[model samples]
Target: MKGSYSLLDIDSSTGDVYLAKGASIGICLGAVKVPRVNPDTRNVTYAGTMSGCSNCFSSDGTGTLYNLSATAVSTKIRPTSVLGSLDVATGEPRDSVAVRRGPSAGMVVDGKNRFAVAAFTAPEGTSYIGSGTAFVPDNNATGQMVIIDLTTGDVVRTMSGFRVGGHGGSLVHGGLMNSVQLDPSTRTGWTYGPYHEQIHQFSY
Candidate 1:
């Protein structure tokens, strides 16, 4: 936990913050870590990890965690990703499916926990910034957005043309607001433009 961190979600049962991190920022080492300090006592309370999970985990506001990508080892991108969930209390994977399109740019579950929408960056090639630094080049690539049924692990509908230029290998990165949020009753959502500063609305 001495490296850079990207906050993924919070475990409601314990109030612990779970994060996706790397040896440095803007890269992933292929694990999600949850380490927390009790607010009242300011003491280390709990620490746990979920191996092989990355980007976009949403809590159903109960205890269920929905994730976009997971694997057995550190693979940045593949033809497909194993979409799954983790136990909020233990940081262990509960269930998964090989139906996700690719690595997620962002994701959100509906208020009912019955469905999810995620951004998948199409698999292209990768480039290295340093001898051991590897990253997905998002500058000229496009991504897909999909609506999925959580229970059946099936992608019911998909929308293409989302962009994926999340972050470069720089020590400092910004403007990569590639996440999603939803309004249940309306069945609509919004996200930032993939290449520019514009807000796009999604209705599906």
Candidate 2:
């Protein structure tokens, strides 16, 4: 495997960082797809992302990141259906062309196994620009959150017109859909993005 793998394998008996370079440069966190092999037919299978970072955000009085630079965010990826065949002879991510480029932040999954990715849409701002300093906003005041559909290999949606650090209280960067939560009892979903500390509530 010439390319690098981001996931790591941990030993139960030992507290060690077994995998090398599991973290993406410039604060990459969120979801990823892992490949597995079945011994019986030598078939390949996929597992969802294990763990990742959440673009840290400052919370309002309610612990929600709303239209703020410090808003927490992340990316998520999961298989909707088997896009690749189980045949190990030819199944090594061959049927997919989904390559994400940006600072990955948070991820969330729904009942249908669909994944929502949240991140700062500044590939040139965070990852490529500095070591760990402040993110030099993309065009200074223009930012957005890109949502990709892993099942269809396309970007399904995007929440644009988000301002980074415009709220005058700490660098209000990007919305890190990191605090998405669903209440099964009420069948309600809550998604908080970057802004002046407001929670966007939705229902099913």
Candidate 3:
């Protein structure tokens, strides 16, 4: 509770709450296992953490936690971006793969863990340094949606030329691209931005 908390996701199967903590590394950056049983009290136990993980999703069947690393803070710059997988029970990293887009925002993993979709906020004329806290997006910046294969970690498809902007919080917290949801049964997904009219839909 001490660190700055941003994005949040829940594993419906286990009732675990996954939280993204800004400026925190290691175990403190992931989920807090069912910290509360009733309304007044909280437990707040650590689930796990991955370097630069700003957004996370948990698979219902396997309980594997998938996170997106959008920036490289140690190198003092934003890199291409990466997606990492972790075993929720043991709190260990299972797999990691590079993402094709840079400065990504929201992400969602399919129910079967077959694929993941991410929303990207293209930083057209801005320069990002040290986790993108100073990034400033220009008018030329456009939105992109990418589908990544979970098994091979490959970008299967990309959709671009949409309205996108990184204007909410600091880029390190995923800017304005902070909302993504997927319906595994229909293979449909939705992404949202700060503007109410900017909601987008996709199908796989």
lDDT, candidate 2, 92-180, per-residue tens:
32343332443334333332334333434343343423223334554544444445454564666655444323221112222233444
> Candidate 1 has which clashing residue pairs, if any?
none
Assess candidate 3 and give its lDDT.
Answer: 0.59
Model 3 residue 34 CA deviation in Å:
12
Backbone collisions counted per model: 0, 19, 1
lDDT of 1 by residue, 10-120 (tens): 555556554543222333446655545455666653344553344555666566666555342233333244566766556566767776433456677884647888765
Better TM-score candidate (2, 3): 3
lDDT of 3 by residue, 1-204 (tens): 555555555666666666654323222233333121212245576666655455444344456767776554353544556787767688777778888535566677785748888777663334555443335446555677788888888889887755554435444435533466788888887776446477677786
Weakest ten-residue segment in model 2 by summed lDDT: 62-71
Per-residue lDDT, model 2, residue 110, is 37
User: Order the candidates by lDDT, highest first — what do you get?
Assistant: 3, 1, 2
Candidate 3: segments with Cα more than 4 A from true spot: 23-41, 52-61, 73-76, 123-141, 193-195
lDDT (Cα, 0-100) at 60 in candidate 2: 20
Candidate 3 lowest-lDDT run of ten: 31-40
| C-alpha lDDT of residue 184 in model 2 | 41
Q: lDDT of each model, Cα atoms only?
A: 0.56, 0.33, 0.59
Cand. 1 TM to true fold: 0.66
Candidate 2 achieves a global lDDT of 0.33
